[model samples]
Target: MALAAVVAVTALLVSYREVALSADGLRSQAAPAVQDVAATRLALLRADWEANWVKENLNGVPAAGESYQSQLSAADQSLSRLAERTSDDLGTINGLLDSYGTSITDGALYYHDDRPIQDQKFREAGSLLIRSDVGLVPRLDKLQNGQMDRAERLATMGALGYTGWVVAELALLVLALTLLSALWVLRDRCGRDYNPWLLSSLVLTVALAVVPLLAMTVTQRHLDNARDKLTAITTVAKQTERETKVDTTDARVRLDGAQTRVSKTSQEVRKELSAHEWQNSVYYGALGGGILVFLLPATGIGRRLNADYWRAR
Candidate 1:
């Protein structure tokens, strides 16, 4: 039982190691990559918004420059940060960011000065932001999907880890209970009410068993929390991408569909993630608990047989 406890612990520690790494990797890797894409997409969206606003109010020149400039400046900061981190390896993405920023900046400038942007020029900047997006969006999609994939894998491993914990704890529990029962039986059979060594062993076994059970309860809660949050964020981001990065063929239609799906889809995804987390934890408990209940006596029997064989030899 002690050896089994060690194995169970090792399995859990090794398996859930990736959970921490996944969180870190998403922040360090996926965040930068995907945020760049998102920022560019937002720039595209904003540029389009600016163009549309101008065309609608060309004669009036409405007082929207402050809000529009604020958005552009914020986007510029994001791009500027990306620029500071550029390398040969990041040339593709760097170029895309630069082009996207240029389009947004130029359009904002023309709109700010209230200069007439020729028909092609007005659309050209927005079009470049969109066109440049072609090279970047898919990579961001992959990174986004990859983060969730890692999370799912961790959830599976966490479930398995909890299962192992349960199994080891059950073995220890049964061993403790049987020994405690044997103490009473020995009082009837051999006239000894207690054996100090047996009492000590039983106490130790129960302590060990209880520890894992308690620890696993906490572990399950953490797994549930991380899994649910990651799922919610991933779902929302995916839906947002679908809405914001519409393709040339029916961008409006796709955007509308994506917008419509956001609320319902996010709710459904969150529900599924929550249900899955609960199911995995429950299974971990059941399988671990059942094995302890049904098969633990065999451990006792095997130990006794080994002891007897050594004595006979």
Candidate 2:
């Protein structure tokens, strides 16, 4: 019975740990990487749109140039953040962005001089930004997809871990019942009241079984909420990507709103996952508590056997 209890406790601990780790990875690394990549892509799109708007309108050069610079800065910041978190080599994307910026700047210079080459420069820059192949946008999209894939894998692992936890809980309940039955048998055979040590072990077993179950329930809820928010952000981003032009104020306003929502949802996910801080404490407590539960039952049974041996002697 003691061995069974130990095994059950170990299984519970391992399973719950897996869930916690997966949740942490999803929250801390994968989710954030996805957000960063998406942000970068959005910023680049807006900046290119601004540049194109200026080229076509031949007016609002000051305002449009300011917006373009601001968007490019935003994209740079997002890329820096992404580089810190991701293992992917961002050198290619960075090089492409630099070349794209140069083309846009040259286009502006040509426009100022009324050079015929202004159109060519703008077209080249636009192609570098949005060409279906070997463009900055496509590269970022590839990175974002990879990050999303990682987040999905982590979420799946957490779910599998939850399933494992349920199995462990069932095993623990069975072992607890078996131990209690054995205790009851000993009490009847020896003509004594219930053993205190074994009784305490039963209480500990109940605690070990119940506490983590509740904690895991809460963790799973948070994980699901985070996943939902991330999906919403992805959907919004894809919608924004489909826009052919952002020349009108209304189009630009919509893009701004979408970006704001993505940022807000990302923040909410981080806040929700932060509530998982208690998982580490619960995990360690379960380890110690499980050992004590095992020891108490063994001590109680050993005492009973020793007493019987003396009586026989």
Candidate 3:
């Protein structure tokens, strides 16, 4: 029993370590660096558009302003693609883009009319653009905080898993000692008789050995499957990242590939976990069944009589 306990504890510790490492690896693959860079570029493009809008629209549609707007729209599209790949924060960007578009349209209308621009309307539109850009800073900050929280939680789990391993080891050691002592006592008391007590000890030793082996095999198999899935996703992601870095490099594409890899790996790990749980159920059931089988002969009438007649009283 003590030996069995030790094996169980060791198995559990190994499993925990494997899981924590897998989780940390996944998180590292999905780092937010790509999104951060994309966001910075997007903000810069928006700022440039705003600056030009302020100057060029002061006296109605300057051709230079019109040209800058076209360039701004293209930049916005690039930013939008980045947003699509990384997050849904594009809603904020979209709002800003819409405000900028509306102001441009309004300014064009006034340009056609040759009417003096109403300062209040222009100010309101400008304010909307400013607010839109400012809104992004806060949202990005929130995203950074979220990423930090994720990283911290993962780190804590790793620490806890290591701690759990220590506790499990101690528990297992104690259990093994108890079991060995019990076996020793059984051996001495049942010295010559092939009676129920003797049989029970043999059966227990058999069960203690077999059950853990079965459980360990199943657990190892599960861990292997999880590792394979993680490997496949990583390979795909790495390939994509490499391709994206060719001549006309695009950070957004590279980031998108990395995210895909991490997401797929996480999914596979989760699936393997569910499967491992079912395997655990079967293993425990088998252990219980084996124990019951071992107890049956000891409960027989003949064995009971023999134990009563000759057993150490």
Candidate 4:
């Protein structure tokens, strides 16, 4: 029983460690990579739209012109790929992209004919684009963020699970102690050779080890599956950003004031991601360490006591 306890405790420790490491990997590295890619994509897409605005409102200079058209084509390809990948929310994004394409097409035609856009018309179309953008793009980004939040929440719950395991282990220890005490009373009462404390301790040891180990294994597996899903979402975001970047570049011209604003907004998003990653990493690390520390004594003492009982009996 004592040996079983030791084994169980060891298993618990290993499980918690794996979960912690995985969380750290996600918060410190994986999550940030995903956010960075998404933010970059958002920035580029906004830039493209801003250029469209500038071409319309600014001195008859079309921001993207032929280059912008080429970029839009690439964007179309990217959006198509995204639609293929995201089987779940394809409809919303596809519709938004279609609307965006139409707007771009109309805006480009107006620019080609050198037709001065009325401020009101520009505002209306711009509002439509904004509606399409905030409606779709941010939601996509939010989905990714939502995964991260879930992971963080799971990690927190895992800690709580660890605490429960600790209590179970302690209970096993107490039970073992009670058994050992009973053995002593038996020997005294019957004039027999029995060590109740030792026998009881053995049971406690097993309980301590088995319960925590099992709980940890199950929880870690859950975390692993969740993290994998998060990673998949990240991959999609990265692919989209890479495709967009292939066709986007900074031009020497101001193009549109809106583009500048988008750049500023993108920068803000980048900063937010950085901060989020840092916060996640720190908290996750602390939780992981706490689990490990809590598990060690609970398992070890029980195992040791059980071993002594077995040897005496």
Q: How well does candidate 1 match the true structure in TM-score terms?
A: 0.53
lDDT of 1 by residue, 1-313 (tens): 3454344334444333334344334334433433443444344344455545555455235554444455456555655554543332445555654665565445554544554554445566555444443544454444446545655554444565556655655555556666767667656765654655455556545544564355445554555555565565545546655555554455444434433444354344344333333434433553454345334444544565576689779
Q: What is the lDDT of candidate 2?
A: 0.82
TM-scores across all candidates? 0.53, 0.92, 0.38, 0.41
User: Residue 46 error for model 3, in Å?
Assistant: 12
TM-score of 4: 0.41
Clash list (residue pairs), candidate 1: none
For all predictions, the C-alpha RMSD in Å is 9.0, 2.2, 10.7, 11.5
| Candidate 3 per-residue lDDT over residues 27-71, each given as its tens digit | 333233233323343433333334444444455535435543653
Model 4 bad stretches (over 4 Å): 2-37, 48-50, 53-63, 66-88, 114-125, 132-134, 137-145, 164-313
* CA displacement after TM-score superposition, residue 260 of candidate 2 (Å): 0.7
Task: Single out the weakest 10-residue window by summed lDDT for candidate 3.
Answer: 29-38
lDDT of each: 0.49, 0.82, 0.47, 0.49
Model 2 CA deviation exceeding 4 Å by range = 58-64, 109-111, 158-163, 244-249, 311-313
**Residue 10 accuracy (lDDT) in model 4:** 48
Scored by lDDT, the top model is 2
